[model samples]
Each structure stands twice: as C-alpha cells, then as structure tokens.
Target: MPRRDSPGPESWETLFTGISHLVTPAPGPQRGPAMRELTVVEDAALLVQGGLVAWVGPRRDAPRTPSTRDLGGVAVVPGLVDPHTHAVWAGDRLADFEARLAGVPYEEMLARGGGIRSTVRATAAAPMEELVQLARPRLEALARSGATTVEVKSGYGLDFEAEVRMLRAVRELQSLLSVTLLPTLLIHVPPETGRAAYVQAVCAELIPQVAGEGLAVAVDVFCEREAFTVGETRAILSAARGHDLGVKLHADQFHALGGVELACDLGALSVDHLEASGPAQIVALAASETVATVLPGVTLHLGLPAAPARALIDAGACVAVGTDLNPGSSPLFNAGLALALAVRLNGLTPAEALTAGTVNAAAALGLRDRGALAAGQRADFLALHSPDWRDLVYTLGASPVRDVFVGGERISL
Candidate 1:
C-alpha cells in the first residue's frame, strides 16, 4: 500500500517486509485499557498501501508487494499524539522560571501580571506571520522528536481579530509542516471583559464564527480560580457543542472548583491539568469516556504539584500524556522525555506511559486511525535505534528516534 499522510483514507498501496518489531498500541487491560490494544510482533513485517497498513505479521509470513523498502532491524512504534498543548504563542517565560526557582510561586507570579498576561500582550502585539515563524521552529522540534499529531490553542489572542489571526496561522502551519495540526479556539480570560459579557461574547460570537468557518475543530476554556469560572466555562462549552465543535477543558489546574465534574457533565473529549483534582472528579472521570490528559512538563517547569496520575489510572480512567508546550508554562516538546517524566513523577509504567502518549492521546483528540499499528491504521510510526522500548524512557533528554514515517513516507529530519 502507498502510505498516506493525512487523516482520512484514500487509494490503496502496499509495503513489503523489513520490520524488526511492530509495537501496536493495543489495549492491554481486560476492562478496556485507556487505548484499544498493543500487539507486539518480533521479526515482524508490514504491508502498507494508500497510507494504511494492509497486512502485518512476522517477516517470515509477509506477503509480497511491488514496492518493498527494507528497514533493517529498527524497532517501530506508532506516531505519538500530543492531545493537549499551548505550543503557539509569543514571548518567553524564562524569567518566570528563574523567579519560581528563587522560591516564587506560580499564583504569585500571575498576581503580578507575569504569567499568562505576559504572553497575551506579546502575542496581541505580534504580527501573524511573525507569530507563525516563531512557532514554526517549535513544531519542527516536536516533529523531529517523533510527534506526528498535536493540538494548538489560541488562548494568547484574546480579541476577535487576534484570535482569527492565530487560527489562520495554525492553518498556515498545517500546510507548511508534515505534522497534523488540530486547532482549538481557547476563550481566554482577559482583564477587561467581565465574566457574564465575556462568556456571552465567546459563546455568541467567537464560537459560532470559528465553527462556521471551520477555523477550529475544538473549543477550550480554562476553568480555574484565576481563569474563567465554572458557570462561564459551561456556557462557552455549551455554545461550542451547539456549533458542532468538540469540547476540552483546562480543568482544576490550580484549584478543584468543579471543573472536572463540569467537563464530564458536558461530555468534553478530555480534561487536562488535574493537579488539584479531588477524589470525586477522579471517580467521575473513571466512569466517563473523557480522557485525563496529564502534562508532566508543566509540573516540571512550574515546580508545582504533579497530577494525581496513579489515582486516576488505578480508578480505570483513560489517561493520556502531553507536553503542554507554551511560553508561560511548559515550553519543551520532547514527547519521549515527557513520557519518561510521566513514569518517574506520576508513577506510570513504561508501557502505560507510552500508551498515554500514543493511543490514548489519539482517542483524547477524537482521532481514530493514527495512534496504533493495525491492518487499517495509518502507516505513521518511528524507527527507534534502541532495541528495548524502555531505552526510550531510560535515556531521557536524548534523541533515540533515528527515523520517522507518516503514511509510509519517510521524513528526512
């Protein structure tokens, strides 16, 4: 099969044997693990055509094809999915990091207009092309680190024109990069707009405009103590649903103020930043389809309490992991290292951590065919130079990814 790069299916093509190990992100739990499954095949081979896997089995039992490219003994895994991110923004937060290291708190920094507002002012003042150029290197870095799919949000641009500009930049990046971009309209919290009117504007004006024009696929709200209130979040999300946009939430990052419960109640695709989430919210998430996206990079960067990942996973919640890559919070984009941090800081198993970044993350973003290696899934994956999968997490802060392929097309980094 000829490998395809986009999300949807197309004409068929085929790939012949040369796979050392095929690590399918299949669900491993009996009660349905966060993702579907991970089927491991040693000395395996894959048949790729039309950007999809037509057949996968041991190399000895591989089917013949017209175009077969030998990959030697490289270990293969599905393309990583980063479901939660604030990767597109202006300005830098290195000073905030230094302050935090000097015993300053994130809440304290926010109170002094050093956190999100810093980025807000810089982003609003920046030209859209400049923002795209600044953001392009970040996406290229992530793609080199083996992330094939990622979500970009527009929280820094709080006004209508700026918001449209950010979304348009995202579309431009989509055309420019090999990675798939999932744009989100983040109804940010500005100092000017009051709670009621801001909510009305986002729901009544921004959501409809964004959804109607197909500029964004999802709507996000930061439902926290310093951000939008629970009621305001609900209104924004409700209007987004009416506009047929998927919903996600920046829930319980700094406080447990019913944001997780609200996300579950409104059927959000995922709830991120459960750093301050309570037991009730964990239970609610475990009983729902909404994925719990843990951002270990944010915890590491801000020096805050890590999310209660062990509790959520043990309670049967679908857990995904991401680099909350942004200027103010998590500014890095190495998903493999992020997975390593997830395992060490949050008590996740290596296998579970890998699944969090791959399959569960795809499910979190409402994507179906790109997170795993199966008969019909996309031929998007990475060829790791390491023999052991744990080596990826073991050698943190390093690049073990030797090659990357999206839809059977080799990406030359």
Candidate 2:
C-alpha cells in the first residue's frame, strides 16, 4: 500500500524539498478557529506535475522527478489572492493624497476634481495602450510580492467607450503579466449626469454589452453617499445577473447604508469595503454565503475606521483581505504588505492573515484552483527568505518572498 500523503502513480515532475514550513490553509473554507489553525507542516516537501500539486508530504517518501529543487530550510506558502482592486487606470492622485494629508477632507477633494474624477478624466482621454503601460509596472511589483492572482476593476471609465477601452487594457495586461487577472466591471461612482439617467444607461446599455461580449465575469457597484443609492444599485446588479454576470459591491465604506442587505439579498459573491459597517451588518454577513472582503490598504491610507474583521470572524463570516490597489485612495500593489496591514490594523494573526489573503480570497474571486497546495490545485506558491512564515507580516515594509512560481513556472522579478 502507498504511504499516507505520499506521491502516487502520477509521476512527480517537480519536487521541492527542504522547506522548513509549508502553509497550505487546506481542506478549504476553514472558519473561525480553524482559520487560525494553520496547516503548517515542518520538514515538508511539495510535488508538482502538469501544473498541479500532485502530493505534499515528507521528503523521505517523495517520488523521483525530472526536476527537483531544495529550498535549504526556507518557508513556503500559498501565493496571495488579491480579491479587490481598481487595477487599470491612468493619471496620478498625488494631489489628492497631499490634500488629504493637509486637512482637506476626502469628499472635498472629490468635489474639487482631485480624486477619482481626476483619474476618470485622464483614463477616458488615454488610449488603451497607455492604460496597459501604466499598470504593467504596478502589476509586476505585486507578482514580485507573491500574488498569484489579482481581481482588477473598471470604474474610472464610466462611459461605454471608455469602459470598453479600460477592460481591453486589462485584457492586454493579462497576456503581459504572470499573475492571473480576474476582471470586474465596477460601477464606480455615478455618471456626471442625473443618477437616474446614469443608472438607466448602465442597466440597459453597459451591462448587456459587457456580458454579451464576454468582456467581464463579474459586475461591481459602489453603493455610498458619493455613489449610487441602494435602489439604483439593485437595478444595476439585477441587470448584470440577467446578463449572467456575478455581482460584488463596495458597501458601507462611508455610511450605514442598506447596501449590505442588498448584497446579501442578491447573493452577491462578495461585499467589500466594510469600514462603516456595524454589528448588525457583521452578523448578517456572517450568516450569508457572500464573502466579506476588507481592504485594509484603503482604511490605512484614508485614515478611515478599520473594518470589523474580528467581529466578522467571531460571527463566522468568510473574510478575505485585499490591497484595493488604485490611483487615488490606496496606491498599493504589494499583497505581502497588504497581509501585514491586515494583521496590524484588522486584528488578525499572521496565520489568519495568510488564510484570508489566499484561500478565502480565492473564494471571493470564484476561483477554486490556485489558492492552496493540494492535489488538483494549481502549482502556485512562494518561497520566502525566512524559515518562519510570520516574517512576512512582521517585516511590514519588506517583501519576504524570494521566489514565485505560477503553474510550475518561476517568475523572475
């Protein structure tokens, strides 16, 4: 009989041994205490073949393979899954950041055309090639920081032509980068015209066009005081679903709106931005199937109240963390540092943060293949410089990642 957890009939193609610790976050959907119950295997090894994890166990029983690598006691963990980001946009918002730093309120900055609108104008004017060029470096940095998958949004381009251009740019970026891009059509802020008219356009025109052409897999909305109302958001999401697109929402970021209820009611895949959510919303989200994807980068950068991650977890919600990479609020792409912020500001332990950024985030993205090291999962992972995995969070500013592999292919940064 084959030894337990040993490589089987499928010959291992790539063997990695001498790992001090291997963080799998395995047996998917570990909730509450289980999330903290890390699946750390010491003196472990992982075997891969055909771009999937074949077996993970002790090196003594590991099968022979054509390619084998020894890590020399370095730690290994699942590659990060950044479930929410505005990844493709043109222009900079340094002015807005500086203004916010100088006592200018966020709303005031938006009104003065220094926030997302500035990027909206610039992205609309830019060609698709320019958008791709701008996002290439930022995306490369995230790959270097150990992110195997990223969810990109199109919100800066509110109009039909601009939205198409933005999504097309993301299309090009997918081919250019090693990281897997999950594109989302985000209904950012309402258009400059009347909110009613803008909602009509999105519902009747944009969603159908995007979904019909298979341009995006999901549709997202910003439901806030500065964005659409709950009723408007409902219409937009409904139309998206009718077009057979999944739904997500930016809810309760600035107010205690009914957006959370709407998202849960519609069975949206994930509800992001919970800075303004309260105990009731937390309980509701915990009971729902939807994911609570908190963006610590946004809260830390904007000086807003951190999302109640502890409450969400205590209530048994499936919580995931993201960098919310964008030009205005959170100009971030490093998922390693984002995980550190999740630990520091969101009240999660290092193990919990690792689980959040990997397995839980993959669920938020509706991707079941690449977040963990197990049989049939994609061979995406990172080798860290330190033997202890906590160094990824402890050393906040530094990237502890030494090597990144996606689909058994090493990414050279």
Candidate 3:
C-alpha cells in the first residue's frame, strides 16, 4: 500500500522543503485587526505544479513527488505587491530636488515649467524602445527588493500619442520581465492650456483606444487642486467604466478636495496618497470597500505628514502600502523600504505592514490571484534570510529577502 502522502500520478512538478517557517495571510484582502492574523507553519513544505501552489503544510505530511528542492531553512512568505508606482519616465528631477531643498514648494514647481511637466517633455520625446529601456532597471530594482507584482502607471505622457506609447512600452516590458506588471492609464494633470479639451480627449479618444486595445487594466486620475477637479475626475472615470476599465484615484495628497468621497462613491479600486485626509475621509473609506493605499515613501521624501493610516485601519478600513516610485516627488526604488517606512511613519505594526504590502496591496490593484500562499494561487513568494517574517519590515535600509521565486522557479537577481 502506498503512503498517504503519495502523489498518485497527479504529476507534481516540484516539492519545496527545508523551510524554517512559512508565514502568510488568508487568501483574500485582510482588514482591521484581522490584518495581523497571519498563519505561521513551522517546518513547512510547499508543493508546486503547473506554476501554482498545489499544497502547503508541514514537510512530514508532504506528498511523495519525483522532484524536490531544499530551500535551506528559510522563512517563506507571499511575494510583495506594489499597487502604485510611476516607474516609467525619462529625464532626471535633480533640479526639482534642488528647488525643493531650497524651499520651493512642489505646486510652485509645477506651476513654473518644472515637476511633472519637465518629465512629461522628456518622456514624450523618448521613443517607445527608449522608454522600455529606461524603465527596465527601475522595475528590476523593485523586483530585487521583493516585489513580484508591480503596477506601472503611464502618467508622465499626458497626451494621447505619448500616453499610448507609454502603455505600449509597458507591454514591451512585460515580455522582458519576470515580475508581473499591471498597466494603468493615469490622467496626471490638466495641460497648461486646453484643460477642458484635454479632459474630453482623454474620455473620448484615449480611454476608448486604451480599453479597446486592452493596454491598461485600470484608469487612474490625479484628483487634486493642481490636477483634475472632483467633477472632471468623475467624468473621466465614468468614461473608463463605460469602456469596462477599472478605476482608481490619486486623492487627498495635498488637499482633501472631496476626492476621497468621490472615489468611494464611484467605487474606485483604491484611493492613494491620503496624506491630506482627515477624519471624514477616514469615515468614508471605512464605510466603503475601496482600499486605502498610503504611500509612506512620499512622506519620507516630501517632508509631508504621514497619511491617517492608523485612523483608517482603526476605523475598519482596509489599508495598503506602496513605493510610489517616481521621478519628481518620490525617487524611492525599494518596496521593502516602503514597508519599513509604513511601520515607522504610517503607524503600522510589522505584521500589518506586511499585510499592507502583500495581500492588501494586491487588492489595491484589483488582483485576486497572486497575493497569498494558498493552494491554487500563483507560486510567487519570497524566502527571507531570517526565520521571523517580521524582519522584512523590521530591517530598515536593507533587504531581508534571500531568494525570490515566481511560478515556483527561482529568479536570478
């Protein structure tokens, strides 16, 4: 008689063992105090077949398989997911950095032919191939920092042609990268002139083209005093919804401006940059299903107040974290640093920070398949150098990732 753990001709591809600890959240977006409830199995093993997790438990009960790879006693957790990033852009923001250091405000820089506009000019001038080349290293750096899935947004290209090129460049990058990429069309800001015309073109021309081509999975709008108003954001998001695209918003970064309320009312997948959010915005987010995504890197770089993450989470809202990797405002590259910063700056516990960076961040992207270490989920996970998974957030200015595996295959860093 065969042992109970026998494969029984199921054709298992790989059985991974030698894990000191396997820590992961449940298979869905965790909210409130539940976010701290991670499942930890000691002396664990994971079975993989067809690039998906087939089974996960103690090695003693592991199924008999033809192949096995020992992981050398490392802690395994779900791969980090970055739901918000403006990773594709050309030109440098060194001058903008200098100006900011000299006490020039960000909005002032935007008003004076700098900030996003400066990158817009450079990114618009670059060919699609050049865009791909420029963005590759940034994505790779994020991947090295333990992000297996990253949402890349095209906001630097505010015009129709340039935006299309940026999305196409993202498509090109998908072929070159091991990390899963989700594309987003970001309506960054109003043009210096033709604000109404630009909004109309985005709704009528760009959104339709992008949706028809399946270039982006979601449409994001920068809803702020310096960007699109709440009304314009509603119009654009409505157009995107009509075309069957998901919606998100850059809300309440520098001003409340009702963007949070609007985003919740419109059912956006997530509302990001809540540095300027208050108790009312917290109440709205807690009442809705929209993920409250906080970018701690922005606070660290811009010297802004941290978002009301503690309040949001305490009010029963689902909170997530990201790097907001960009040129002008946030030059952060490491997703691990983003998680660490969330703990220190955003008032999240280490476990909550990990949940924010993993499953909740995946929720922010409207992804349901790759954020947890469960059967039937994608085999994307990280091996940490220490047995304690909290070190991923505890170790600041350094990475605790020992190895990264996507689809059960170890990726070279």
Candidate 4:
C-alpha cells in the first residue's frame, strides 16, 4: 500500500484509503431481513469534505483529492450510536448492586429507597460543575469504546431545579467532550408524597423551562409499576410534544403496563427497555414507526430476560441497541460491549447488531446525519483493529476499535 503524509486536521477536503473492508448499513432505519443487510466494500476509500462524507466506494474508483490519509488496511464501520443512556449522575450504587446480588428484586430495592431515589438525593446535592467533572470520564470511556454519539438523560435529579441543573451539567459536558451529546429530561420516579403535584410541575413548569432553554431535545418518562403510571406518562409526553420536543419511554422492563401501546399512539421516537414485552407489545411496535431500543447491558447487569429483539425484528420492527449506562441497574461503559452482548443475549446476528448500534440507533434518537458511511452523512466512523468488522461483536471483553473519527477528524482515544 502507498502512504502519504496525512493532511492537517483542519484540511478542507481529505480522502481516506487503505481500508481492508468498509462495512455499513443502508440509509434509514432497517427492518425485518433488511436489518441483516450490510454493504461491504473491499479496498474501500472514503472522501470527506467539510466534515461530511462526499463519496465512498472502491479505492480504484475514488476521485482524486489533494489531501489523503491511509488507514493501514484496517476494517472500517460507522461509529456506534448509544441512543438510550443515563450517563450523567453524581454517585455510585454499590449498595444497590449488593442488594440485587443477594436476591432482593430491583423493584423491592427501589421501593425501599435504595435505587434511583438514592441517586436522586445525592445528585440533587451536587453542583453543576461537580456533576460535569464526574460525568466527563464516563463519556470519554464511551468514546474510547467506539461511541461517537451518546444520548444522556437527566433522571437522577427528580425535582424541577435539580433536573434543570442536571441538564445544564450535560450541556457543560458537551462542550468539554468530543462525542456528540444529546440531552433528555427524564421523569424517573414519582415523589413519595405529592405525586400529583410533581406531575403537574413537570408538565406546567419543568417541560416549558427545559424546552425554552434548549436544554433537552427530548423528554422521557419511566412508565412502569414502580414509576409513573400510564396516565401520568401520557400527560407529560403530551406536554413535551406541545413544546416541540421528542418523547421516549422507559417501559416494560419489569412488567407490561400498556406503555408500549401508549408510546406508539403518541408517536414517540423510541420505546426503550422492552425486557418484559410480550406478543401484543411486539405487534404494536412492529406496526409503528417508533424504534424498539433494547438495552442488553441492563439485562447483563440485572440478570433480567433479554428484550424480545428477535420477535420485534421478525415482525418488521426497527430494532436498536443501547448501553443504558447508569449507576444503578447498568454500570456498563463500553458501546462495543453492548453490541457483543446483544448478539449473545438478544439473538441478533453480528450484522444486525452493528446496524442496531449505528443506523437504527441513530433513528431512535431522531438523527438522520451520522449513522452510515455514505454521501451526505457526517464522517463519523471507526477503524477497527482487526481486518474483519465482525470482530467487533465476536470478541468478548475487548474493543476492536483502534481509532475513532468524528466529523472527519481523528480524535485522541
């Protein structure tokens, strides 16, 4: 292979070559058998201009450019997109972990104030700068593990002021990190007392303030038995839609509470944590545009049943994977490991797992920009350490990503 001095990071146009294989999914969210489809180009070259992909094809047919970089014959794939995560928080859940390990059910821990409520109390006391400082390393760890885009939810701060502070912390982290951060205002759990007042505050005060400040692009509700009821979720999500913010739900993780049907009816961007989804829920998801996002890391950490990913996909639903990175239920930091576990737990093929972590995941976040390595997409991709892209999912306890690029510029890992 021929090599040339790499262009400066600020170069206007650059062509990248020497890829052993370039694997990517088709444009848009894939469903059914299409989810298994991947385009593999041998000896591929990518042309990036102004931080967007200009062309991608065989190197022999690649248009010549003034600046070029050879990736040294490594496999390349679209950078992983983590669409569902609770990545911003203040404290650890070590005690909660121990209790769960001792056979105390997760709901039992939450009811006794050892789960999300525990984190909420700690996070509410932390300053915004402290929150940012604490979350920086976790986001960097995700970046190093092949995640170029991560969705961060502010759920630990359950009250109005605390929640807004949490969103601001996420904004601060965004400026200090290389990965793209999408903030969400998550309504985690209702207060022990004054549940009605809290829901009213979220709809009449928190949603409006967060939307007006441009702090969050989406609003999420935890609709389950131990969280907000289905009726309360409807009101909160309706307020978000009125404010032009997208909606998502943490549903069916422990029991089917009609959250999936409500999400579909509301036209939510995605419904996540479907560990308890049944045939009826799968049917509803398959018929709706809402992406079904499965969090394998949660299953791995909590010892829960895997979400019905195979059934959803077979029924033509768009399926995606996420880390659900959080202190309580899931402490996973690696996006690559999420994909690997999805294959073993969720019955997704390596190709489907890659698509789930990329294009479909992007769709779940309502982003059409950076999931595929094709013209008009952002030049965000990964150069794998191995020649085969499947190694990313096949390898256990290791990351196959050797280098990561965002907006056509290489980022230090």
Best by lDDT: 4
Maximum-TM-score candidate = 4
- Scored against the true structure, residue 20 in model 1 reaches a CA lDDT of 71
Give per-residue CA lDDT, model 1, range 303-398, as digits (tens). Answer: 779998888888889898999888877877787778889999888887788788887888888887777778778787888887555666677767
Query: TM-score of each candidate?
Result: 0.93, 0.95, 0.96, 0.96
In model 3, the runs with Cα more than 4 Å from the true position are 1-12, 107-112
Instruction: Please give, for residues 194-306, the per-residue lDDT of candidate 3 as tens digits.
Output: 99999998999999999999999999999999899999999999999999999999999999999999989998999999999999999999999999999998999889999
lDDT of 4 by residue, 1-413 (tens): 10112334544798999899999998789987899999999999999998889999999999988889999999999999999888888878998888877989767987887888889999999999999889888898999899999999998987789999999999988887777999999999888899999899899999999999999999999999989999999999999999999999999999999999999999999999999999999999999999999999989998899999999999999999999999987899999999999999999999999999999999999999888999999898999999999999998877789989888878886
Q: For each candidate, what is the lDDT?
A: 0.81, 0.86, 0.91, 0.92
Q: List the residue pairs that clash in candidate 2.
A: none
Tell me how far the alpha carbon of residue 191 in candidate 1 is from the true structure, in angstroms, after superposition.
2.6
Which ranking of candidates, highest TM-score first?
4, 3, 2, 1
Candidate 4 residue runs with Cα over 4 Å from true position: 1-11, 105-113
What is the total number of backbone clashes in candidate 3? 0
Question: 209, model 1: CA deviation in Å?
Answer: 1.1
In terms of TM-score, how similar is model 4 to the real structure? 0.96
Q: Can you give the lDDT of residue 127 in candidate 2?
A: 94
Which residue pairs in model 4 clash with each other?
none
Predicted candidate 2 versus true structure: per-residue lDDT over 1-413, tens digit per residue: 10112323444487999899898787455566767877788889898887788899877778877778888899999989899988788889988878878999877987898888899999999999999989888888888888889898999987889998888888889877777888899999887777798899889999898988778999999999888999999999999999989999999998979999888999998999899999889988988988899899988888899999988988888889999999877888799999899888999988889889998898887777878888889988989999998888888667899888887667777
